[model samples]
Target: MRLPCIEIIGCIAAIVTVLKLVTLDTFVFGDVQETFILFLNVHFLAALMVVFALAISAYKYLRLGIELMPIEKYVFRILISLAAFTGIWALSTEIIRYFNYQELTSAKSVSDIENAKQLA
Candidate 1:
């Protein structure tokens, strides 16, 4: 079943709205830092979904014997490759951030202990 262009656009808009709602925060009642992190996570998940959908569509086309032109095939391959690379890059960045955060908190706690010892 083919979706009309307007319906597709509406669906995209609705997705964006939901994303906005999920990430919404106010300075009076929320931590901006946490909200930003949540936004990044949401964005990454959306990207992953898009990549998965593209892969599935490509697979379906191939299985159904629907042939793409040479240029189309090249573009599809390039997009898939880029998406995979981006996903890897994002994962690595998040991993590094997690380790850094752990290190920072550990260092802070050690310093706090030292300060407490000095106070005693």
Candidate 2:
């Protein structure tokens, strides 16, 4: 049996969510490039990709007008929910990591330095 479009979308959302998070980290952590730091922080490029996906999906939905069948509708919901959850998790993780990095890099304390460079 074919899977619902929503479920498929959910899977794609989940994967894309992870990708987005990883890309964000590359910017926030300063691991990617210090020169283009502003670009990463703003994430205009990623935002564009996200907007494109949503726009395409919306356009298709409007054009199809319920021709997606029950499965497809369910898939859409599942996809959207998965993406949302991934986003929440990514944001929280980034915040936590930021503070951890700040404390470590700032030379706040023995523990902070240790914690910050714990991976190193």
Candidate 3:
């Protein structure tokens, strides 16, 4: 049987999300600090796209009669999934922040020194 349009869109979005995440460094268009700032926004948008795809897929499966689970049942599933996804993302960001704490602090210090020198 042929796949539905929703499935196609979801699949394409999923692929794009994965590709974007994997090659995040290449998306930089400027210096490291600027690139990091831009990357934060891009990553959030990419994550939203992934959640959108998941929503579409869930709707398709529910309405198309693929699974016998009731709509009410899926509400819990969706909530749990969202919580899990958020938790993982939060953990990842913390890990990155922890590891790069020194680099980020140093960058700020360096910028502050430059600004002070300019004002003196």
Displacement of residue 2 (Cα, Å) in model 2 is 15
Please provide, for model 1 over 67-89, each residue's C-alpha lDDT reduced to its tens digit, 9 standing for 90 to 100: 54443444345445544654565
Candidate 1 yields a Cα-based lDDT of: 0.50
Candidate achieving higher TM-score, 1 or 2:
1
lDDT per residue as tens, model 3, 87-119: 456346534644455477698999999999999
Which 10 successive residues of model 3 have the least lDDT summed? 25-34
- Model 3: how far residue 62 lies from native, Å: 2.0
Q: Estimate every model's Cα lDDT from 0 to 1.
A: 0.50, 0.53, 0.53
Name the best candidate (by TM-score). Answer: 1
Worst 10 residues of 1 by lDDT: 25-34
**Candidate 2 per-residue C-alpha lDDT over 1-120 given as tens digits, one digit per residue, 9 for 90 to 100:** 435666466557746755765565434645423323332444434543554465455455546646777545654554455445545554565465556556555655776778879878
What's the TM for model 1?
0.51
lDDT of 2: 0.53
> Clashes in model 1: which pairs?
none
Candidate 3's displacement at residue 99, Å, is 7.1
> Model 3, stretches more than 4 Å misplaced?
1-16, 19-32, 35-40, 66-102, 110-120
Model 1 vs truth, CA RMSD:
7.2
